[model samples]
Target: MSEADYSRVSPFWQIEFFYCNSYLQSHSLYAKISASESPMSEMVEVVIDSIRVHLMAPQRVVVLKQSSTERYLTIWVGPYEAEAITVALQEVEMIRPLTHDLIKNIFNSFGARITRVEIVKLQDDIFYGNIVADAGGREIHIDSRPSDAIAIAVRAHVPIMVHRSVMDAAGMEPDREVPETNAPLARQEPPPPPSSDDANRLSVFKDFLDKLDIDSPDKDKPDSP
Candidate 1:
């Protein structure tokens, strides 16, 4: 090739180099942003232990038990939210779907999945949480009440988390030793024997009806007594 042809080749190489540099810069920026979004200090994983309610009052609380520690976190919630959390923990179906159920359905319809829930803050006796969801390539962080976040997390079978700072501030240990027998067991009931009154009620009723029948030709009319 001639010297002019060599100049043409140089421009092509320059363009290729520029494209590669631009791509690397864009990738590095994305990495930095992702790292910033998710810090190195990981949150502690937790599970919903129970929902408690005070008698004859609207006040309710949801208890979260740390999976990796012996600490617990309690967050007070409203009656409706408490019910939602209880329903999810019991794996019970409601006659009408509750708010959390509706949200789960909406997420499914949009092909989105809740990946995690984080109890990120507790300030002035109030708690805050976030729902991390994945919709295909996009991940979203939604601000939510701790109760609602937990309720949805149970239904989604997602990991529930507490910020290390939050745990350090509010985590509590059980006041009493937990009994090993307190663990859940399969419920069993004694079998009702065939001789039980309830088991013979139907046959007893049939016998009484046969004795009272008066239309049979061979019936003894009680000796006219």
Candidate 2:
């Protein structure tokens, strides 16, 4: 979409697209936000643990585990974004490009190399995140939902980071049993009440601006710039 044409589209979706992901509301814990100017120092690296269904509800959640740690961050995502994430992680060959795949392709076409994806803050039960990219020696940050950010990270083979404070706020201990493998984990302990979908969750496509390339795993690490 042309810049002008993009602007002409509804403004609600533009600002509200990333709002699809929310802190698993079934738990009683409250959210605490601490914004950081230096993400490298403040963020904790995490890996996709699994995508889980509520078991009893109509919701799907994407779980992020602190790398080499036991704590996990679980965020509820819409069915569409949840499926998009699963498809990317499973490397399901689609005959056509999904919304997120298209965004990665857009980044590649424009020389934007995705370095890392971060879940930066948690507030009002919402998980906020961003995509950081290197485009021609310049860095660009695009605000995104944790779910969407994660979807992109898996496709780009990048590391995912969550702010320390956010983790402290919403992160929870894993189930008693340990999975024997790193493959996607799943369980059912009766999830907290599913969150109601807000009107803003209707965004069809996350805006594709600038970004696209697969950087090395080392460069995609939390310590890398």
Candidate 3:
């Protein structure tokens, strides 16, 4: 779609579409969002960076990057939940259903579907999440840990959101190098890692624009020649 066409969509959906393409890479999520009334909750959309298993400690971390923002949130999770998120992100299917997969199946059989997951709070370094679903003609919100909530959200192809207050307080710009973990993010997926061609092309194009004498958005005057 053209930029002009995309601009016509509501900002919520603009982010939703971006999330679909960037993270899920599936149209199912887009379809689900479009079918529901826009949610009234004020939340910031975020995408999972990857599941990081701490090599130095017996713990796991799930990193989340706020959509269209520089802020990142890191939550410590258990190994089981870390594996669940890994399998969902990598699209790994087991011969027998894992616990998370079973939960999803139970919801499906009940005609309930997860609409979104929200990281609603952070206190004493612990983050909490809520799973929003529709079942029996009413909305249902279940309290959860950020890890388990994220795992189910990815499996359901639903949007994950973080409350603005929580993000503002706890989010940080990630370091130049992400820490090495027992679970390597790159190896989770089967496809060859993304080539740097697109990044290089975009970098070159940005440099070209930088060379032009363009005025800032706040400044109407042209640059001094």
Which run of 10 residues does model 1 get worst, by summed lDDT?
Answer: 29-38
TM-score of each: 0.59, 0.62, 0.59
- By summed lDDT, which 10 consecutive residues of candidate 2 come out lowest? 204-213
User: Which residue pairs clash in candidate 2?
Assistant: 26-192, 26-193, 107-211, 107-212, 108-212, 112-212
What digit string (tens of lDDT, one per residue) describes model 2 on residues 29-84? 31222234444988899988766655346666676789868987778889888888
Q: Which pairs clash inside model 1?
A: none
Which stretches in model 3 have alpha-carbon errors above 4 Å? 1-41, 174-225
Best by lDDT: 3
Question: Per-residue error at 83 for model 1, in Å?
Answer: 0.6
Candidate 3 local lDDT, 170-197, one digit each (tens): 6765436757679977777675754686
The TM-score of predicted model 3 comes to 0.59
Scored by CA lDDT, what does every candidate get? 0.69, 0.70, 0.71
Return the lDDT, model 3, position 31.
25
- What ranges in model 2 sit over 4 Å off? 1-37, 175-225
Deviation in Å, model 3, residue 43 alpha carbon = 0.7
lDDT of 1 at 221: 17
Candidate 1 lDDT tens digits, 1-225: 466764777777868867888999776531222221333266888887656553335566676789987787767788777777767776786788788889889888989888988788767657777878887978777777788888899899999888887887667665577467754566545556667543443353233323433355343111210
RMSD per candidate (Å) reads: 24.8, 16.8, 23.1
Instruction: Assess candidate 2 and give its lDDT.
Output: 0.70
